[model samples]
Target: MAGTPIANSSTKCLPEGMPSIMGAIYPIEIMQDAKRLVVLAEFLSQTRRVHIGEKMPPADDTEPSYNGYSVARWDGDTLVIETSRVRPDVLFFNVPHSINMKITERLRRSSPTLLENKVMIEDPDYLSRPYSFTFQYKKTDYKIGEFVCENNQTKVDAEGKASLQLQPDTK
Candidate 1:
């Protein structure tokens, strides 16, 4: 019980961290300092801050949140991040991760202007073995927009049909 607010069976309302984990599939903004790193995604305005060279806190100190408890270390030029304690949430392509799940990400500089993140996901409760993939990001000067998820941003109309605003220009 990591105090993660999951959607109840009766109410399919979006949870507190609805798209935080879901946003993992898209582009991210990486902000790093001497002791920590921040992974930010414009969509849903989700962010995960990883403490560098730090051990996982005591169990009581961690909650099964969207991004889970993440720690990172440098392996030569690459940064290795290990994350656990994620709630049973949709982590990738409609796949849910159990609390026992762990994700290992190896991020390295592919080129002077390109970065790559190779992720490995493991969850015995759902996945057969480990799933691995890589996502790349090109260094850019474009600024991130202010994107936030609003309550009932998506809704079912009177005819009992779900309506989703998919256009990027609309809020």
Candidate 2:
């Protein structure tokens, strides 16, 4: 397990050194059947970005690789997600989360169509603390559209490359 803190940012850019998988995307699909809710998202990569729905806006060129494979199941009203088999190429930009890194997310519906998600990131290779984050989503009635990144283009420079920006320990 790679030890690394999954950086939190309003932007979608992943940290440096973390390779984007082939099909990772946000606003994953949640299918509910009886007591079970299944969530699905593609694992995306720099070389191949998966088209799940409508093409999302291009992330910052300076951003690290984005996207990963994730699935979630509902436990009662709370959603529990387990993410694995992550690509080690860019792990959170440069922090280097291992491919064995495992992430768990807990989600709860704050409203009929709104869900709040709390994510926990764990890795043995790059993190000193377990990273956590929260995100919110609203349900939409629109159908999924074609999302493709083949035409999206950006220029990368040395400064744009993902890297671990560590702060000095205050202790």
Candidate 3:
């Protein structure tokens, strides 16, 4: 299990992307307006924009990127988001997915302090069929802080284990 590149990108301060971004270890900020919804992640300060009330373009027209092209609409009490053209490598973990991969997320509030997200992932070449899972996030009182990966020094040994090289505060 050593020498694996599971955190390869994160090791270099790259965006974790997609599902990885949804991990609860860090908090994300969501902002909305009449035209688009914006999500800001604590890691790398990554951002994803989901346009509201717009037609999703074919893959041919959507250029692949870390977060992919996304469009959103309201379905009664739920907010539905369709994402496509994500750089296959950034789809799930840092692992690669087929270019045909697609992700759809339906989010609704289960309670005043709880938000539920149902995610469906599809990739004809990588999966036998589509699969889905639901994730629930509870409202927290934590505040977002400035995160700068470069400030943390780290060293990876030959066995692929990474260690933090704690830096003394120069303040």
Indicate the TM-score of model 1: 0.75
lDDT of 1 by residue, 1-171 (tens): 363333421123433242244234445688898799887776556678788999878757888886788889999999998888776754444567677888888889999998888888888988898988877778888677776455354544454344443446655
Q: In candidate 3, what are the lDDT values of residues 83-135, reduced to their tens digit?
A: 87777777355346877778899988999999888999888888888889888
TM-score of predicted structure 3 = 0.82
> How far is 162's C-alpha from truth in model 3 (Å)?
3.7
Give per-residue CA lDDT, model 2, range 1-171, as digits (tens).
264333332122432221222112443455665444444432122222222222223333223333444445557878576555555665453456775576676768999888887777888777777888777777887544444332123323344432344555779
TM-score of each prediction: 0.75, 0.52, 0.82
The lDDT for every candidate, in the order shown, is 0.68, 0.48, 0.77
Whichever of 1 and 3 has more lDDT, that candidate is 3
For residue 103, give model 1's deviation from the true position in Å: 0.4
Order of the predicted models by TM-score, top scorer first: 3, 1, 2
Q: Could you arrange the candidates by lDDT from highest to lowest? A: 3, 1, 2
Residue 146 alpha-carbon offset, candidate 3, angstroms: 1.7
